[model samples]
Target: MSWSMSLTSFPSRIQTHPTIHLLRPIKPTISSPPKFPNLPTIRSVQGNFDHSPITPAKTRWETMLETAASLYPLYVTAGAVVACLKPSTFAWFVKRGPASYSLSLGFIMLAMGLTLELRDLLNLFVQRPFSILFGCAAQYTIMPAFGAIISKSLGLSPALSVGLILLGCCPGGTASNVVTLIARGDVPLSIVMTVCTTLGAVFLTPLLTKILAGTYVPVDAVKLSISTLQVVVAPILLGSYLQRTFPAAVKFVLPSAPLFAVLASSLLACSVFSENVVRFKSSIIGASLASDLSPVLCAKAILSGELGVIILSVFLLHFAGFFVGYLSAAIGGFREPQRRAISIEVGMQNSSLGVVLATSHFTSPMVAVPPAMSAVIMNIMGSSLGFFWRFINPSDSKDSPKVDDK
Candidate 1:
């Protein structure tokens, strides 16, 4: 009997054959099983597997939402932790408050400027100019009006009322674009609106505040405009020019914007607290007492209790701005994305600016409460809204109607 063996390089295996008994080397024969008698003979199946179809890509809005969803928790947590630690660092922060607030404002303006492009400005002449314009109008008009109404209705003190109006009059926050993007809104449009409103605010904010807040509290439009232009417009223009001219420079500035903003805000918070401590020390000490406390302590306790009111009013106004801004956009023929953008843009005022203005001009720490508290509340509320939108939307994983931009 002959036996043969073959080695296959493809599978790296040795094949043995028992049919051949002689010592002859040859290729082995492999065959399919024979069909049973009367059974149908099967041939083969052929198709193109390499060129199979795949799911479509997600839209820009969908991508934005996913990104926002991922980062929102960190933003909220950071803001909360910072705020909780304020009391301990109060004195240090207050001493450098104005400078810190100014730095933050400058950084935010610079970031805004860097983000802007010529094409974005050209978008003003495109199909949805009215949408942008109306959105801006709604933001400036409705928000301040609501603030004024709320302040009056609540019978808040003059300082609180003016603070609310000041907050309302300020431009949309930097965070607005982020929230708008997450909500699947037109991010470019949001950015443009923010830039326009912010620039316009260099002049308009002072004018509007003087007109609206003057009735409630003393205001100096000229001084306010100068301050705003110095802190907001100048930095923004410089940053935008740098971004346009040297794109790489933005890398350094972008990360620094938030850091500066945080630092500035912390300083502003400290300044306000310190001023409050100094001016209303008696009242605060009095209010701090639990009740049936001594007169010396009673003063501190009263001031401390007033802080609670200040915090509450700030929260109320911030939330109200957010809710009203979103609802107004939705009612005004805006879709989900645009509405989200509008809501955020309207809701989150530039509270850092408000703080700076209040502290520099008002001389009363109480006046700064609305803006400082607003800064904290807006971040929390904006983050919450972003998270909620993401929770419901969940990127492009779920089926949604395709947006028709025509």
Candidate 2:
């Protein structure tokens, strides 16, 4: 139960109960890396002036935006609940055209790409190839496998099963980067892992979804691959190129990019939920009737039937992913921050992508439900984990420049 025991041990310890207390006690002192002679001091450089001081207005604005960004879980939770209650609120986001899913996802991918630098990817592979490869491998393998097992164990319908499995096979979410930053984990590694898994999804997502979900329904791997390339790969590369070619424009857009992506993802998930509200209401009623022994138990029964199973199954899948991912990285001899990065990367699936793929490729709207629900659940879980680690590991401050560098 000591920090020195290596992070791989978390799975075993947390299996009985995954909670904040599972972390070891540590002094709240910051840990510093070894110092070298005559190293240059890092400073933020703005184009206008050599000695321009930060103004109160500018600081307040930055603080306000950061506060908003950190409340992502709140926004997502509210959005999901509203979408379920009144479909019209989010339905318009998708009704504009057939390409709504693709456009939303493309914009999200473009925002992610703008944050990345080519050297960041290269440096990650060159410096810590094992961690990157291990994370990507776990991303494709562990979650997909867990998804199928959890789906079958829960005895979900074929459509729901496929949706859950598709979610499992998807890439690490862009939000994982922000969560990693909050958790004081290896941000560079998180970003690199996200990029690697996302690019790898072009091949792995379609193929794995076909292999794992084909039994549930017909899966056209070729179509999925093409769609992924169009929605994901192309936009990301375009944005990355844009960042390099037009640094000025990128600088202007970079501050708002993460928030935009977060909002887009929330809107996309809400839109899907809105589209399926009728079916959802009917299912809730049916499930409640099936379990209720008397009229008095009607409300309670709905909480224990189909909806309950879906929520439980999704929770187990992600909890297992976060635990197993940490174990895997610990086994690979990585320490605290890298293990945290891998855990978050593996656990947080790109739910927005899952929603798009399920709805676009599958005939049933029900197939999109799990992913839509996941958009809410994963953020809550990720943010909780981040804040927990942030408290215990005070030494891993967010202000450290090394956290941003590979």
Candidate 3:
């Protein structure tokens, strides 16, 4: 009652006397802060992301393709050059007689000669001698048999028949070593087998040819032996010696050897082609005879219409060699790599050598046909087979036993 009355009185008084006092303002102070109930705590940052690199495994097919692609241009160029070379350019070389041919042959032999030391041979012996031996035996046995049978059945001219047999009698090629490496086979073993067979063939090739081809051609064993010694053995010995005595020179030579070999082979091919061009032309013309034609026409037919049959047989023989080599190694308890080496060594033949001999000695284009065809066919077939083995038998390649190079 007093407060209300006082306010009213104050209002009346203020109205009456228009003067009043003002009150001062006071500040308030805070006591404590509130906290969040469920907030998460912060952690340290992660280190920089990893940036390590990775590598992929290489494959046999990749190797084969790479090597083949690299070599194919050289092969084509060599073939083209040989085919186009003026006959007159080579005529002088040929007319200069057997001596020039012998010299060229000698060069080939020297080029082929491997610079394998005693240690390499010892390594081969300790690692896989049996596998090597079996491969060699299978190569010699099956190939010559196949060749003889095919040649006889085809009723080819005697010179041609003998030529086929000689082709069979020859050793596995140095090229096989390269192919084996591409296939991821045992390269060292392949080299050993190639070298061994080549060296052995110095004597065995002539003996085998004389025995098998005596009826078909005048295989003068004595003269042939001398020719082989002059053309093959002497040069090989010289080359091997040079490689051993002059290692630096060999380093330079080795890189160019394949190219030189190709050139020499192309020249040899040209020489053969020029001489046999007429015969090959005639054979092509003659091959068109129908199966039911007269005997006279059949006889006139080059390779006796048996060319097809012989080709088929040779294809079979090649496959057989591959199989035999592989199986033999497997049976002998060899590891995967050695088996692969054996298979390759058994399958590939030195057809170039055969072509050279056929051209030099037989002088028949028909005789040269088998080796010429073989040179082309084997590469195609071998490469295809290698692809299959790599794709289908990959585990066999990697997990199978290995021969220690050491």
Whole-structure CA lDDT of model 3: 0.61
Q: What is the lDDT of residue 190 in candidate 3?
A: 74
Alpha-carbon shift of residue 62 in model 1 (angstroms): 21
**Residue-by-residue lDDT tens digits, candidate 1, 1-406:** 0000111112222344446436887788765544357744332111101111233565675455445434533544454455444444455655666776677667656655665664546544264576678678977887788778778877888988888888889988777766765565556557767777888887888888888889877799999999999998898778768877887866444534444444445555445544554444455545555656777666555634666566666777777777887777756665566666777788888787888888788866677878866766777788788767755542332243322233
- Over 4 Å off in model 3, which ranges? 1-101, 283-317, 363-365, 390-394, 397-406
Q: Please state the error at residue 231 of candidate 3 in Å.
A: 2.0
Name the lDDT of candidate 2.
0.77
Candidate 3 per-residue lDDT, tens place, 141-191, comes to 867877777778766678667877887888886667666655666666677
Q: Best candidate per lDDT, number?
A: 2
Instruction: Give the range of the ten consecutive residues with the poorest summed lDDT in model 3.
Output: 1-10
In model 2, the clashing pairs are none
User: Residue-wise lDDT of candidate 2 within 1-406, one digit each (tens)?
Assistant: 0000011101111113223343688555544545555754333221111112333343565556656766778888888788778878866676873388889999989887887776656754675676678789989999999999999988999989999999999999988887877777766667788888889888999999999999989999999999899999999899889988999998676767777777888888878877877766787778656866466576566656677777787898899888999888767666577778889999999998898888789998878889988988898998899888877673343443221213
> Predicted candidate 3: what Cα RMSD to the true structure?
27.3
Q: Name the top TM-score candidate.
A: 2
* lDDT (C-alpha) at residue 152 in model 3: 80
**Candidate 1 deviant stretches above 4 angstroms:** 1-93, 124-127, 251-263, 270-304, 394-406
